[model samples]
Target: MEFKPDWEQAVRRFEAWYAFEETDRPVMIVSAPKAPRQDPPAPGDLLRRWTDAEYLIARHEAAFRSTHYAGESYPHCWPNLGPGIAGAYAGCEPVFDETTMWLKPLDRPLSGIHPVWDEDNHWWQVTLELTHAAAEAGEGRWVTGITDLGGVTDILAGMRHSDRLCIEMLEEPEEILRVRDGLLEIWKRAYSALADITQPVNGGTTGWLGAFSVHRTYPLQCDFCCMIGPEMFERFVLPELRELCRWLDRSVYHLDGPGAVKHLDALLGIRELNAIQWVQGAGQAPTIEWADLLKRILDAGKSVFAYASPQEVRPLLERLGARGVALAVGASTPEEADYLVRMSAEWSRP
Candidate 1:
């Protein structure tokens, strides 16, 4: 809260945004480069860049300190080993890349492999090491978020390959559900493990969605849901998602693109879900143009978050109102960041 004079005020905005309640303005996360930008030399090897805890923490701290975290944006680091990391924790080997890690599928059916948390999995260890280092470095200086533990259905797809999982679901529905249920337990255990380290250090929680929570909060998602229809989603995905939402104090569904929007009605019906992060996907349209879809989510009484350019923020807020919307907007200067904060109040509606 020491980032600005009104830091506590910004926290209040986030709390209101989470509850879909009235506030002075919508919560916006805006960050701009420091006046004199600094860039460190790139690490030589991609593997070391990811697994080297010291290097990862240094980079996180550099970015955390150099940028101006405006609006609801603040210093937080999640040990991202890609979104499918839970698959690796369950025994699938991960092929590394600069941007994300790919979880290699099983050569045979996953009927034999029981999903459980491997405390000694290399990537899991990397996650813990990186998180521990970041937590120590950021103890009183910043808020460090939990790792992306991932969704159960997505982990199943990652382990068995999406197409193979589809066939397995049709051929052996009960076994597939059993494995999914096991993965759900691992997911819950992973969260509790990470929370044990993160919560007392900062007295709050956050996840890859870049939102803050006073207690347990997450951006729950199932990217594989896009490949399946509503019936399959209800049978395989919905039960676990519903259970997660019920267990967590705050939860947001990550609804991605037109493909997954088919499940929007079902997602909106979940009384425990607190919000939605609508990722409209690339090469389609600016999120500002999707007012009707966003308003539909809002009308369903769930808070929503979306992306916008700085120029789009005003009209976006004007159309959507200030009640239950949060946006991630980019700024190039401190003045522009300040302007967006003011515009939030100016454009807010009843």
Candidate 2:
């Protein structure tokens, strides 16, 4: 282990609550991994997103500590694999390496409307390896699960050109659904396998939380809603998502950027959801611009899991309160992490 956790009791307490067992520990903070801005950037602006084993470990370690520190906080972190893993099951190709994995389309969706998966697929094997390794590393610190939805909708765009998918929405709606359904079937199997391989923190128990047990928290996700109108999402995308959510536990919907705000209502309507992790999406909003949106979600009676800097805490506590807010901040030393924790506790206590 790269970092030997100093908070073992905290870790056990979190594991208990995460499995939905009652615990006497008090809650203080939330656990989440910071999304690192990739370096040596992807060549050509092809919208490349990548994840490596080391990065995944870092995220898991951070999440374990955050959940441990909070005592009663949710222990959540993703398998953090590459974006194209899901599409590869649908017959696309993903490039893999030590640091990150990426996907480049071999054929357009219209060329082969159907998708296929086998025992030796590159992305599938790589993702499975990374997921297994992450679970081993968790070591009772926190529950580890797979990363993003493998860019589900975006990969569809990459496989079948976005324009083609748009046209297919009308020309071949059934074909689009077939491909989407196939991708989802693979996701369900992956999640089930992951969930089965990893059991409840108490070791395989069936209950309220077990039914929602996820080996990984952020398994399937997409930001494509930012590009399409709400009408398109409601008709083409929403039902597929509803079907997908039914199979897993503790989903945290990723609200990417302001443009995707329109779909928030649709996401909220899904009763199985545990919380919404809102990414204000860079620039000035990381400071204060997101406060309004945070308040809106809290007002809707949903728990909010988001990153907040020390500077943003006062206004955030004033507006959204601390009962259901999760904060992620960068602290260079133990002293700083301690100070921030103390400040957050004071603000959270009524």
C-alpha positional error of residue 5 in candidate 1 after TM-score superposition, expressed in Å: 6.1
lDDT of 2: 0.56
Compared with the true structure, all predictions reach lDDT values of: 0.85, 0.56
Model 1 C-alpha lDDT versus the unseen true structure: 0.85
TM-score of 2: 0.73
| Tens digits of lDDT, candidate 1, 13-120 | 787888999877889899888746454666799888777767766777677667888888887777787886877888888888888887898887657978877788
Every model's TM-score: 0.96, 0.73
Best by the TM-score measure: 1
Give the Å error, residue 332, model 1.
Answer: 1.8
Maximum-lDDT candidate: 1
Model 1 misplacement above 4 A: 1-6
Cα distance off (Å), candidate 1, residue 228: 0.7
Candidate 2 lDDT tens digits, 1-350: 22324345544432342343332322234332333423333333222233355555665564445322322233544565555567776667666665565556545445376665555766667666666676676656544544444545667766776776677777887777777777777766655665555454413212111112323444234676677788888877887667666655545566778888888888778776555667777664573567888778766765665666656765666666555465555454445555665666555555
